[model samples]
Target chain A: MRAVGEGAGGPKSLPLILARELAANLATPMFLIDAGGTLVYYNDAAEGLIGRSFGEQGEISAGQFGEMLQLTEPDGTPVRRRDTPAGVAFFQRCPSHRVLQATGYDGVRRTVEVTAYPLFGTTDEMHGVVTVFWETGG
Target chain B: MDVGVWGCRGSLAAPGPETIRYGGNTSCLDVVLSSGHHLILDAGTGMRPLGVMLDNAGVDEVHVLLTHLHLDHLQGLGFFRPLFRPGVAVHVWGPASPVQSLSDRIAIYLSPPLFPVRLADIPSDVTFHDEPLEAVAIGSATVRAAKVTHQGPTVGYRIEEGGASLVYLPDHEPSLGVTLANHPADWTSGYELACDADVLLHDAQYGDDEYPRHVGWGHSCVEHVVDFAAKANVGNVVLFHHDPYHDDDDLEHLLVQARARWTSAPERVRLACEGMTITLDANGVAFGAQAARA
Candidate 1:
């Protein structure tokens, strides 16, 4: 049977399409979210950190992404998603970075460094945001 | 608004005795708003005739919304009468390229050994819009262009005028990345444009039996197109971009298959044929005359 969710159908603008392509090429973990805050794509490297492939998650809302991966400070202090790099980049339309602790879909907790930036066109048109992160936990 | 198909033949211009019934031109559509605004959807060979009609009507300005720079889609630009007439304002809009600007990409074909005339050699005052993510107003009509899945940089347009919406996705392949069945409306490519549209001219270039061989070709088969229309819940589905290889009988067969699939289609499902016009008003969609033979 054909696998679902790798590159599921969605209204992807050119920038998002190119971002997804770029993400797939990078060995680092990456995730692509749409203007609507829907998690549209994630790279194969991201699958390890995510504990599941993008084909498995399909498309999830931003809130859903938060619920799927609850994050906290290194000391286990609860943190709001809006404080994360992805959240700041999405809401502020700028670049952001952070080191946080999180538990992925597989219930494994890990500390990771995350960097995110809004995807923009040459004309400064906002397509969405691309989030990349490094995993410290296996 | 009145939507007319000047050329529905897809891929290549198939002018022959077999294609006479459906007309043998590539993908050009003529849209006339009630306010006398003229919009040509593509610059296929059918555009030549549409340009002549505009010239006969003495229209000094026109907008051509292109889906992409594919040869069949751009085949009629050189012959379009308005582009050759001085004092004519020709506005062309299409998808943006990664390496070059839209005008430069178009110029690649308009100039050189491929064509005798250069894009600059045209007499009309031509303007090219590289990428159009923002909606633009042409008269009272609002035109929105969205990127769609195809072989290259391509987009589908949604034209909303006077409470009626007509979406033109002449060369789309929404089934490329994802399966069409039970997919969320928002997830399907070109869904937003076709959602509740009064008339949708969607790509239905292949039959189901032939789709497997042409998966990445960026054209939709009858079954897939019907599935997309159902998901979009459009009012009427006008099967567009007929394969140049398919003759009238083949198209008729495809239509029959489409009807079978869309049994509960709200208004109806019809094939886009050359010279076929569809009108939209407060009363709803009304079929206009066509050059089709009995």
Candidate 2:
């Protein structure tokens, strides 16, 4: 589609596009969740971490995500989705990551620190959040 | 690539008469480049002796790099006299912690149940920098860090200067199934961290037979060390993190077995000892007194 001269020629939408590229380039696992705590956007690292594509599945509940990652405590007890850091962060509207370890397998026991923060809209309304994690518990 | 191992041990500080032969201190290494900049890796119990050496030598500002927050790497920090003295600034660098920064990690090691003195109580001007693993520019040397196969969020260092590179992977487990299955390309195949350096100081806490039983214990066998060095094409491989039960004679036997691999394809390999110093030239290759310094 051909665009008008001013709209096509000007540096329109450059900053927005650059910001989106920068977010995609992050090395750590990053996933965005909606106000209802449903998975929305997951970067490449987040995909590798979960061993599957959160984007392909679309909306993933906090409980389902925790089960997929085999989330556990330092003592190796299964982490309840309700009590999971992501759930808590979502409900409490804050950032949190608890009990991390390095492990292999999707839905198998591994050490990792999980975190969640509330996303906000421009009008100060709740929009979505991002969760990230890494290996721990040596 | 000019590399040296000042101190290497595991678990706790093994300072005693029995350990005197191997210098019973913990982890520490002094890497010097042709530029005269010194980078001290880990401040384990070995730092006590290192501090004395540097203080007597009139080193004003020494740079310390830490791999993790384990106590063994930090126990000797208080004993390092330079921290208690004024005008001697110790610039410390470590991996970024999820809970706290590098300075906060050091503070946790000091004071109360951990130790008597607080890190803040230390008189020296100390600056802690927590950054990602990469080629970091310090004083006159370029220090690089590679995340290694360890239990926690740990990393191995590759300190280079004057063209010489020393690879330090003190606490790595070669057969980490989890790390391999997850980041197969990085950890499993061989050591991604210690490849093709002038000197590779690696964890060799177990013998060949003992490694299987200690799987997932976060340690390596002598065989793993030899294999990794050969695979990486490292110049000189130094067996580090020796088990306390294995005395110098036992280590020598292990060295014999390790050196035999080189018979078919010669590789410079040896066991690290206390007070061992390997001087490198402008080329970043070790020269003069190739073996452990006595």
Candidate 3:
């Protein structure tokens, strides 16, 4: 988890600040992945859903996130990076939603419905992507 | 105030010839105020010896402050001889979960199936109190608890008596707070608890090379501990909670490496060894004879 005023490697951008503020007050599971695809922050509610806090695990790279979450389609096929909600939202620069199966770090698997959207700066440049999700069931 | 290290090893008791120099018992400390008040920290296997000593000394009343209900920390309570003495009063204090009282939380391990006797079956008069988040007075000492970054709802303690203060955070992960986006204020609470303390006993359970694999394991590497100690400006920093795999020689090497990182008074950094006693008073912090052996 990067500090609120800092990004993965430098001072925080405007969109990063917005993402941090949005994640701070969120009660539902929410996480922010920077433009570099590094997980910058995950809220407390998100920690409960993931079975581990971002603080404890430290920053999760995009590849690590894919491997750890083990996101899969309803048909048991692996979700490609471009097809994943966060990937679509960041790369495609649009809001995306999907119902997928995710495995937490503790090995608990849950069917989750997730909504992802890109956070853009004042000049319309994408800074990061925010993902809000909840467990659909066991 | 005087602090005694009964056990400093983490995870499990590692009693053997190789571990004898540093001691193998898990996480127990004895803090005695100049006013004769005794406070015990974590009832790990080391507490058995402490209990025997206290019992033999005819000390009737004792207060135990537990950081959490981890098995290694609670395992020694069953063997603590003082609890078997009739009419002796033992007060236990610890963090309570939202759904369970501290007494009930401890009873889960102290009861049958897991253990031979129930907490209620102990001969001594025992009482459990949910420790407050704010500072509370226990005899002549005042202690405050702050939530730390750990796997569970673990808390670090700061004990102050007279003009001396000691901070104990034997299981902590400073890396957890680096991002500070989740709980920004919590990132500073650990530092605040140890700020200018006479002695800060912190977890140094891994070496720099061994930390990547054990990240988020609720323990700190020696480098992190040294960095935190220097940031807090503690008078003395004792590296406690030695990993089970680190033997006496390994710890000596780690201590040397840890001291080299301390730009401040390098002499202020030390390792916590079993039987070592540290006394803090107006005169300043003084190490007992055991420290000389180390």
Instruction: Please name the candidate that would achieve the greatest TM-score relative to the true structure.
Output: 1
Residue-pair clashes per candidate, as listed? 1, 11, 1
Can you tell me the DockQ of model 3? 0.03
Docking class of 2: incorrect
Q: If you assessed candidate 1 against the hidden native complex, which CAPRI class would it receive?
A: acceptable
Q: How well is each residue in B1-294 modelled by candidate 1, as lDDT tens digits?
A: 998889998989999988887888999988889888888999998988887888877899899999999998998999898889899999998887657888888888988899999988899999988545667888889899887878877889999888999999999888875568765565567877678898889999999999999988999999888899888888889998989889999999999999998878533899887878899888888887765421
Q: DockQ for all models, in order?
A: 0.24, 0.04, 0.03
Model 1: per-residue Cα lDDT over A1-138, one tens digit each: 111122335556656765776687789999988777778889899999889988878888876887678888888887787888889987788899988888888898999999999876544567778899997663
Which ten residues in a row are the worst by lDDT in model 1 chain B? Answer: B285-294
Q: Higher-DockQ candidate among 1 and 3? A: 1
RMSD of 3: 12.7
Q: Positional deviation of A35 in candidate 3, in angstroms?
A: 30
Best by DockQ: 1
Q: Give the clashing residue pairs of candidate 1, or none.
A: A5-A55
lDDT of 3 by residue, A1-138 (tens): 222222464434434544565577778899888877787778899887788987797776766887888899866789987789998986787999999998897898889999999876422456678899998884
Colliding pairs, model 3: A1-B179
